[model samples]
Target: MKKPLNAPVLIVGGGIAGLALGIALRRAGRDVELVELNSAWNVYGVGIILQANALRALRQIGLADACIAAGFPYAVSLHHEENGQPQAARHKPSLLDEGLPASCGILRPALHNLLRDAALAAGVQVRLGITVADIRDESDAAQVSFTDGSQGRYSVVVGADGIRSHVRTLRFPEAMPPRFTGQGCWRFTLPRSAEVSSAVMYHGRQARLAGLVPVSPDQMYLLLLSEEPGNPRMPDAELPDLLRDRLQHFGGQIPAAMAHMPGPEGIVYRPLETQLVAAPWHRGRVVLAGDAAHATTPHMAQGASMALEDAVVLADSLDDADSLESALQSYSLRRFDRCRRVVEASVQIGQWQMRPEPGADPLALVREVAVELMRPA
Candidate 1:
């Protein structure tokens, strides 16, 4: 009789993609171990907006309801002019008429805690402050050496690591590195007001984009995207003043929100980076998923959702395939087109935001992509 499939799968990185895959694999009756570079499972950023597709993926892993309960869900998006006057508003098209809201926003730490706890509860072996030092992919298994100097042979090694994935560096040495998208995003948390009922996007002249998203009953966060070439790193002390200056050009509720900025602690800033690793996301017993395979810009707010979808699809593929190679190939085939579309569309949106096309309606592009993403991954 043929030998059974490899056992004890090893997942590198404990981020959303890694943890979600760990949960799904363990549920499929496979031995799953996950390692993270950070000792403490911490997350940065003020808040995250979970689009409907993301909620659908989380719902598959049985964590959506808990998240929705802990977050603020709203179905509408308001577009405003540079002066803060409302230009237009649209409600997300409901994919399912059921009670599920179109989208939700939550504090980043809360989402991380939920996933980490759920992964641990699902019987995943999580090792913190550790990572893969070396990986040797053989015919049937991958021999992985941890940074801690310990070693284990796993049936499959998944690189769910983030955009700067060490696993990707090791596996795809020839792949292009992530590139700056000529824009950077600034985020800060502020108290919510009664007037801020929906997610609002403020578009100023010269390709300036800002958003106010509600994360809870009493809290919201501001996101500003501006042209920042080369992804320069700014000191923490200067962040508060720099962010305030960036918002000075806008009016409406933004000025009020800017007044609430406590200091540097309330601000988070990062340049947008993106990359789409070419096909064949696997080699031998090693495979890649999530940002490791395709890291997209945040214009669509589908980064986490794409990662979650990757986890679910990968686990399901392994369960149905006759062998490991078949499963990895199947996962790549199912994922490539969908991910490419999102990455391309998001990058296009960012490009358009940086330089508006004459007489072009960029909002329509945003809406088109949103409708496309509403379909199942």
Candidate 2:
């Protein structure tokens, strides 16, 4: 018989993964406490693309409809040549049972707000501007010391703290660290055009990739992926012009969008990085989820979806297992392969982009992965 998980669950780093886990566990009738290092709880990225699988996962927690309503839902991705000529259009089939759209594009803050509000409504205890300083896994529970000079004991401590996770550092000192993927991403927001109803990609020279995604009814975000030899960081004051220059080769609506680019403050830039820890994602009573265990490039747009699936599966495992050890093992076993596929595939696509093969088909690989992801997480 499985033992009931009646003890409190401590989730570190209240980002997408942590918040989703908090909501899932709380809905499962477990006590959950979430801590975020940032007091204001601000999100950095301009927008995110949620694929069908992500929406399916969100549906399990009653947030799928809300996300669909808030974001722009689309089923087709349009590909164009560097000079604005249409190349191809790929239509994605809906994975949801109720015929929901195949994908959604939403602002980062909007998605964060939805998850945060839902987590709070589900009765998660939230502590901001805090993080774990130390964690000692005892037989009965894991004792945690917070950076704010507070302490607590919980049945399990989950590290959803992201790629540079502190809890992961303390727990898995020997695990692999995050690696730079030799590429940088740039994003800028602009008014959505009437014709921009779906995701549009423009393949540029020298393997540069640019795309436009509608985030809402009236707003869309432009994204560029470029090879950065040393991952150089440009000054914030120079980001606007720099991004404009990078997109100079892209035609279509890109030129018009660039014309209205805001000052440096409007540009969002980040060097792509990825990490995937080898299995056994848990040690003692400490477990890692989301980017803490596997951080993938945005090439697949499955990073956040994978995190959401982790939260749901972890909660389900805990509820069905006979022991904490067995539950953690089950969760890791189920998640590792799926997450690894995404990380590897995404990295592979980025690598191919950096060094294109004569007959390599990234779009085909993407379609293959998308079909695989249509299965239940």
**Leading candidate by TM-score:** 2
**What are the lDDT figures for the candidates, one per model?**
0.87, 0.91
TM-score of each: 0.97, 0.98
Q: Which ten residues in a row have the lowest lDDT in candidate 1?
A: 1-10
Model 1, position 49, has a per-residue lDDT of 85
Residue 201 alpha-carbon offset, candidate 2, angstroms: 0.3
Q: Which digits, one per residue and each the tens of the lDDT, describe model 2 over residues 209-284? A: 9999998999999999999899897999999878877888889988887877888887889899999999989999
Model 2 clash number: 0
Steric overlap count per candidate = 0, 0
